[model samples]
Target: MSFRNFTTGQSHGFGGTYLKLVPGEMLVYSDVFDDPNLPGEMTVTVRLTAVSVGTEMTVVQENVPDVIPVEACYLGWQDSLRKLAGLVEPEITG
Candidate 1:
């Protein structure tokens, strides 16, 4: 799926297909980011492990673009995951 960046009005987000998925277990996908400065593609892997109290979700984004700083991406992902966890975890907990 293609995503647009509202801030920059750029279609610099992911546009790809879902490679694999196993409910409550794992997911894999590929995406292309058409960054005007650093266009590239990547594979994203999400793994979920069940714990006694909750599920542990891990995200691995591979094949990063050289123009994009890994540290900035990491921080962005952290914020995204935090928001996602807030949205998803409560449903599972309830």
Candidate 2:
């Protein structure tokens, strides 16, 4: 089994972005406006892997998406959020 974490964020004034973090010292996605005037919100996602070595478990591999669509306006916030979530959580498990 694999563990996954998904996140989403939004802002009204400037813009929005997305990020994802995973195991094995991997960074899913990251981006910055560099301009203070580009105020916005961002979301982060994380995934953890487990490895067994001599009765010890550790992270093996991870996959992180890219942080893009740095729109300066909150236009496709909802649709984008849902799309991101879908990518993060393709299936539901109990």
What are the lDDT figures for the candidates, one per model? 0.79, 0.38
TM match of model 2 to true structure: 0.21
What TM-scores do the predictions have?
0.72, 0.21
Q: List residue ranges in candidate 2 displaced over 4 A.
A: 1-75
- lDDT value, candidate 1, whole model: 0.79
Per candidate, the number of residue pairs that clash is: 0, 1
Pick the TM-score winner.
1
Lowest lDDT block of 10, candidate 2: 56-65
Encode model 2's per-residue lDDT on 1-94: one tens digit a residue: 1112234344323223435444454444333344455333333333444446422222221221224343412334445557887888669589
Q: State the displacement of the C-alpha of residue 24, model 1, in Å, after optimal TM-score superposition.
A: 0.6
